[model samples]
Target: MSTTPMFPSNLLPNEASPEWMNKGDNAWQLTAATLVGLQSVPGLVILYGSIVKKKWAVNSAFMALYAFAAVLICWVGWGYRMSFGESLVFFWGRPAVALDQKFLLEKAFVGMYPTATMVFFQFVFAAITLILIAGALLGRMNIYAWMLFVPLWLTFSYTIGAFSVWCPTGWLAKAGVIDYSGGYVIHLSSGVAGFTAAYWVGPRASADRENFPPNNIILMLAGAGLLWMGWTGFNGGDPYVVSIDASLAVLNTHVCAATSLLVWLFLDIIFFGKPSVIGAVQGMITGLVCITPAAGVVQGWAAILMGVMSGSIPWFSMMVLHKKIALLKQVDDTMAVFHTHAVAGSLGGILTGIFAEPKLNRLFYQVDDWEKYIGLAYGLNSGRTSAGFHQMGVQLGGILFIIVLNIVTTSLICLFIRLIMPLRLSDKELEVGDDVVHGEEAYSLWGDGEIFDNTKHYTEHNTAFDLEDGSSSMKKTATEVQLT
Candidate 1:
């Protein structure tokens, strides 16, 4: 029935696989995006769920889960364009929906892939930033308040930072601020915004604050391993191509993380008399954050130096300085995100200006301007001292902008959310934890649909007795029956 003549031989390029599209690049971008998404979904989810007190495990993990879903919805709806669309102002982009097939199938602004790939890649970053902020508010923030806070903060604080630093037309970008990945847009912003939100949400219950311990250290390690490996995508995909720079970025990311972990472990042994696993995780995270800005721009030796500094500086900040600073002491950063992300991120930015190689910058930025992007050390050696100092100034300026932006925007968003609902949970809910708040628990091992009730058990002579399975009598000490 003339099947061969049904279609013309000369047709327009296929929409799914355009002539401009690079299949390998598209594949790697999608794979990298999935890897980044994994870092949040099961990685942070498991970490948050296992790292908190057992009573609060469900709540902590749910916060991360909800942010991931909510951010994807918002990103496709309008958030993506707001962060990367046409300029609405010097620091913001025009808000526009990113779901149109025409837009999605087109070439992306930066990568050699469809715009859809870039949107997905960027959405994972936005989602993780909100999840990081959740670490600070866990154990006490009202679910409704958090629900409101996520979209609000994403709309206000996140988009602004993303637009200002990442967008090509951004003032900061034009001014030569270097954020190879998201040391500024994600890490620093999350750390400062998280700390600020924690201030407004208030602390957890006094009892929880005093005695909180990880419910599952082993599971925490597993989650952390996922996070560590997933960073291969985090820094690698930033180069927007499958090239030598991308390979170098991936190698630097892991090297810095390992070095930072060892340094932090050694510091813990020297000062605390024990090598803390939690300390190692914090070190790894700081190293990841610190190297993000400079990953593709610095050499292997520079990455190692950055790792050492990241491990030691953030450790001291969290261990010694946090206690000494009144403002830091007042803010109850549950995950110490301020130290791991904010401090490390800013340090990375400054060091990027110091150690970034001019040749590497030309490779990444595709610019050979000797007067810009020159590291301070290189500048002195190259007789371009002005360029180096200028790069350093730009880096410092970016850090200052992020800190002030997060503090102000986060405070306003929290205050606005407070007008709609209470920011903190009720005292009873705080005391009872996940079971009271979500009507669920992380572990239901004792009985089907039943939460352990300390009030129902009686303790005498260090022995406790309570009903088991609603039909049998079980004997155990109150301490033994208590959930971990």
Candidate 2:
């Protein structure tokens, strides 16, 4: 058997091509990274802050923020190596640091582009996947436990999925599977892991259930916009180098998102009296996530159809199906990660089988060994184009492989962490918010003195409570919560 080299001696394009230095794509990559960064830091950060009740706002934001920071450090230090370094195991990458500028400037892999661009591009995917998982375990999980879990899960789970699907030597890659973006690695894996982690962590406080309205709608909208714009980089950058197809990928991603949003609005108007901003945001995210795996592979029409399934099916799962299914409601997935990521990702993977055009695949892989490409080829594009089942079957195998892996691994890790220390915070801390745990509050409107027990309450109610008992001593006491 001939062994394949880890790093390709030369990229698919010659080493001196000006397209490699297009600077436009480079700018796009940086812009995309910044946009994606915004999604986690302020985007998901504020969205979670607003969606959860005030009591848990800080906690929710902290969960997302901490995961973002923690993943970056781990990614550059070690996680990146494990995912893209080399094909060691059939299912995972070999471990090695990607530190020098030399590696970045060179071609990424045999079939890809500049290594540096690839590294930064893949880092965003890794970071976001972890952040996505944070959605499920937000309110109740201990910050300390979460800190430990992030790195552990990255090492044990995230890398394996990345290597298997994207790395050249990965079994799935060799088997001719396609993931234009991260339906399998980012969405599907994280969705399953998120749900499993939530199952292990349990639910929020009883009091939180009685009143859990969003604290700030405007902030949530800002977050939503960031998530929407970030797709430019998320899917666009997947091609590894700046190219025409990368542009097509970005266009396709947005088109799918727009179509899904319209369909969702239609569904909401038909069923509910009003279309909720929350519903719109959910539709937007599901559309984006659903198109991820199939972004560059299928036709634009296929993307629209995938969006419909993504928006409707996940909406149903979150709205009706989860309520009807007793087992699903048992695990409180704080933000419907399973529906948006896992279900949508899986559906995208399956649709890729039905809708994928082999011509697109050839264009993506930049077929050099025509014999090899032809050997693995399924069929042609459009109705006139011949189709085959082999490619579709391979795609299905990837979905199943990732699902089983995530479920088993995430559960084991969470259970193991629980054995060492309880995953949830105490009853008292749940009410205290992020100020107590991380020593940081997301928003502070106060211009002067600290808002504390000693200071008189501001806004509505004009009364103070007695410190000794849990009773309101003053009859005219203001009930506005002190904002610090």
Candidate 3:
């Protein structure tokens, strides 16, 4: 045989080529998609595992892992088409497979790249949204029940929000509702859906809810750091090409996150008398969500103002309002996702109408409709106050639509899941946590590799108890792994 390598007969010399494609854009898009994927996989995975009670670590992490895989399978099968394909109506596209090679290689709308890149990029967002919702149900949701809930919610609640707010043909999009990268579709929807599901699934076991503590604060920070960095792609990739808007979005994202985190830390010190790392993380998340809808369209100063409001407002909701509000207290939101995502997301949408810059809006949305995208502050400056109010109205409308949509869809889905099987874990499973549920422990520390016993582990003085291997546990205390 010749020394030359053989090519498949069906493969063309430029098989990866699309005449309209920008190679750089395609590469960046794929990289961005992977970054977003990393946020859910190791980022949220680590975050969930280490942020829950030690006994629930494995279960919480597994919930996120399973959703990531499930969403991808559903995404390529029919979910992608329903959200971005041919319009089925004002808020949905016709369901169809996104896997055909020819279609995957075709140019995606707006992006000068193959449709495959768009599919993967969108899929990561879809997956992460579900994972965020999982945060609320952590420490208690039944795994098999969660398996069914993921696909169902994705199909019903997530797709509608995405198509309505993100798809070019969506009614909200046509109406010029700003959602540059899923403040409404992903963050807002996940927050609301998670809370609603939590209400229906019921609360975690009383003990777990009362005394749950993060398993590993350092590892939790590591995961949070990844999520913080991964947002570079989350907002930056929305424009679907490298440009000044992308750079502005990236800068604004970090600026807001830093500002919000400090504000939250300050609030925690003043009230709780400590600078909680978890509080700082929540503030960072709220800031990220707050700027998401207007990230590319707001000036730097406006981003700072939005960050300040996001830091304080969501803090109030989660800390003060959650305590006073009966509905909030009744639904044990294990991760406070409603405050971090839903409240912050709605706040961002409204603020987008107030802070969105006309010139930047023109650059990001590529629209010249002075009547449609002008922020309220700019409207006053430019003598277009009525137009700014209109934009605000549209933003409010989008928020209402999303909230009502999720409330109904999520409730029905949860009820359906309940009919099939209990949504929450059994009492024994809840008592034993990950070990009884999954037959696995997150960390192994027994001298003889025996299963963990709460009575023998927590509450009891392990330092004085004898090990099964006839070793004096008190002598080996320093080497033992312990839960707080």
Q: Order of candidates by lDDT, top first?
A: 1, 3, 2
Ranked candidates (TM-score, high to low): 1, 3, 2
- Residues 40-141, model 2: lDDT tens digits: 777788788888876578778877888887887888777887888866777887776677777667766643346676677677778889889998887789
- RMSD score of candidate 1 (Å): 5.8
Model 1 accuracy (lDDT, Cα): 0.90
Candidate 2 — which pairs collide?
104-116, 461-478, 462-478, 463-477, 463-478
Candidate 2 deviant stretches above 4 angstroms: 1-25, 100-106, 110-114, 369-387, 439-450, 453-484
Please give, for residues 141-178, the per-residue lDDT of candidate 3 as tens digits.
99999999999999988988899888878999999898
Error of 2 at 39 (Å): 2.5
Looking at model 3, which ten-residue stretch has the lowest summed lDDT?
466-475
RMSD of 2: 6.8
Question: Candidate 3 — which residues are off by over 4 angstroms?
Answer: 1-15, 367-371, 448-484
TM-score of 2: 0.85
RMSD of each: 5.8, 6.8, 6.5
